[model samples]
Target: MAGYKFFMFDPDNGFETYKTAEEAKAAADEAIDYYRGDAGDGWPDEVAQVCWGEIKQETQQVGLRPRDEEDKSSCEMICDYQLTDI
Candidate 1:
């Protein structure tokens, strides 16, 4: 089935597809939280904080498009998680 795709601006990341927009948004929110120091350990040191700070900036900026839509900056692929896999 076709999916909804969202572009995550993290340099190491790319377009990700989900079965629904809610799922995509939830995933993005989780990543945003992690980047904001929601990780259990938080930022360990200044260098680590500084490095991930850049990612935190970009992670807040996201773009969404339908699966069939064309986006020159990224490509899409489904990454759905199955219930059984949970």
Candidate 2:
């Protein structure tokens, strides 16, 4: 399951691993749904406009992913990962 690094950049903060692009998208979807449930269809947009005066996403910029075949910048090299107990 080796692959090139996937960097997740937060506009308000530093970079971190998004695990995969799909995971990043799923996280965004969940956030939007939760906010919409609490507010309305335009929940996220409305909140952003009121708070920051614009619309923004949680996952801001996605960094460059190297070519997998070349095995450049491995995911492990980019992200801090460890196991945890339940």
Candidate 3:
């Protein structure tokens, strides 16, 4: 199937994407859990708080903007998860 892009926002980071909404949301939750130390040895409260704040701001910003229909090859929304810490 042809790939479609979805936009997702990360608090600490900026914009991102996933092939599907489910994939993007799963990634976001995983990131939150990981940062919060659900897996153990989580990030410091200060760091986590800052990161989360950034993500929340970004999400809101993107949500307020108009959707881009020109980018058919990419998801319309952004993915807010990262494999590495920012």
The superposed Cα distance between candidate 1 and the true structure at residue 4, in angstroms, equals 4.4
Please, what are the lDDT tens digits per residue for candidate 1 over residues 43-79?
4333232211111112222344445555444456423
Global lDDT of each model?
A: 0.41, 0.41, 0.48
Preferred candidate (lDDT higher): 2 or 3: 3
Residue lDDT tens for model 2, 18-47 = 546665555444544455685744444532
Error of 2 at 59 (Å): 18
Q: Give the per-residue lDDT digits (tens) of candidate 3, residues 36-70.
A: 76336656553343221122212112233334776
Q: Which stretches of candidate 3 lie over 4 Å from their true place?
A: 38-86
Return the TM-score for each candidate structure.
0.33, 0.32, 0.35
Per-residue error for 76 in candidate 3, Å, reads: 31
Q: Candidate 3: TM-score?
A: 0.35
Q: Candidate 2: what lDDT?
A: 0.41
Better of 1 and 3 by TM-score: 3
What range of 10 consecutive residues in model 2 has the weakest lDDT sum? Answer: 49-58
C-alpha positional error of residue 29 in candidate 3 after TM-score superposition, expressed in Å: 0.8
